[model samples]
Target: MDATELQAISDTLMRIVTPDMTPKQLIKAARKEHPNASKRDIARAAFFSIIANADQDHGKAKNLQAFAIAERTQNGAE
Candidate 1:
């Protein structure tokens, strides 16, 4: 996807996710919100969102990064 599409997906994921959520929970929530999106796409958007927010929210970034890693691992894409 292009930068703008990626940003939009990231924004959507950020709105749906919380720091307390696990990787499965995050992916489930993302898939619920974006039923047509591929799992890899959602994971990529989530990763971008985590990095984008890292400067302002390190704790959240860490949690979300963990979720992304778990998602990647579960999908055998890591």
Candidate 2:
């Protein structure tokens, strides 16, 4: 995808994912628009978000990781 297409996909993802949404939720929502996007693609998108959040604020990565762990525990996710 081009830069414009990527930005549009990112924007669509952001709209679907909220603070309360889990990674699984975000991926599921992303799949609705990008059915052919691979698991690695979804992971890369999430990772980019993680990096961006980390860059915006120190310790954000750790916090997000911790949150992800807790979310996985709560959801019984592997």
Candidate 3:
């Protein structure tokens, strides 16, 4: 995805994510505003968001990174 799409997904994730939210919940929530986003796209956005958000919320950024890795590897995604 392009930077604009990534930014949009990142923005949506920032708005929708919560401490209690699951990976599936995160993806679903993000997709509501950006239905064309793939798991890879969301994962990229999550990683992108991490750099910008780590200082303010390390745990949230870590969770998002973990979710991104999971999305990339789960069920033999490759």
Best by lDDT: 3
- Please provide, for model 1 over 1-78, each residue's C-alpha lDDT reduced to its tens digit, 9 standing for 90 to 100: 778877887877767667678766776787776677787887898799888988887776777788778878988954
Quickly count the clashes in candidate 1. 0
Which lDDT value does model 2 have at 26?
64
Q: Write the per-residue lDDT of candidate 2 for residues 1-78, one digit (tens) a residue.
A: 555544455555545555666667766787899887654455545445455556654454444444445544655654
On TM-score, the leading prediction is: 3
In model 2, which runs have C-alpha deviations exceeding 4 angstroms?
Answer: 1-5, 47-78
Candidate 3 TM-score, true structure as reference? 0.83
- Candidate 3 lDDT for residue 53: 85
Please give each candidate's TM-score. 0.75, 0.50, 0.83
Instruction: List candidate 1 segments past 4 Å from native.
Output: none
CA lDDT of each prediction against the hidden true structure: 0.78, 0.56, 0.84
Give Cα distance to truth, residue 28, candidate 3, Å.
0.7
